[model samples]
Target: MIRWALIFLVVALIAAVLGFGGIAGAAASIAKILFYIFVISLLISVVMILINKSKR
Candidate 1:
């Protein structure tokens, strides 16, 4: 998931550099969304681990 976010980020940069405004915007937005999703999931996993440790 993090990998995908990075991929889209790079694609966005390349598209913007190449003067493809629409594609660049879309890719940037998608990268932002993916990054948020990845962060949220990682946080949830950490919380779950903490909860499990506490239960032990």
Candidate 2:
């Protein structure tokens, strides 16, 4: 997921450099969304793991 976000981000940069404003904006938005999702999931997983460990 993080990897995909990074890929999209790079693609967005490339698109912007190539003068594709629409494509760049879309890809950048997607990348930002994916990055946030990935971060949230990672945080949730860590919290779950900590909670489980505390119960043990």
Candidate 3:
């Protein structure tokens, strides 16, 4: 998931450099959304692991 975000970010950068404003904007937004989702999932997983460890 994080890798995909990075891919989109790179795509956005390339598109922008090529003067594709619409494509760049769309890719950037997708990347941003993916990044946030990845972060939230990571945090949730960490919290879950900590909780389980503490229970043991």
- Top-TM-score structure, candidate number: 3
Clashes of each: 0, 0, 0
* Residue-wise C-alpha lDDT for candidate 2, range 11-40, written one tens digit per residue: 999999999999999999999999999999
RMSD of 2: 0.6
Candidate 3 achieves a global lDDT of: 0.99
How many pairs in model 2 have backbone atoms within 3 A of each other, for residues 3 or more apart or on separate chains, i.e. clashes?
0
**For residues 1-56, could you state the per-residue lDDT of candidate 1 as single tens digits?**
89999999999999999999999999999999999999999999999999999999
Residue clash pairs of candidate 2: none
For model 3 the local lDDT of residue 53 reads 100
lDDT per prediction? 0.98, 0.98, 0.99
Ranked candidates (lDDT, high to low): 3, 2, 1
lDDT (Cα, 0-100) at 44 in candidate 2: 100
- By lDDT, the best candidate is 3
Model 1 superposed RMSD (Cα): 0.5
Residue 49 CA displacement from its true place in model 2, Å: 0.7
Rank all candidate structures by their TM-score, best first, as comma-separated numbers.
Answer: 3, 1, 2
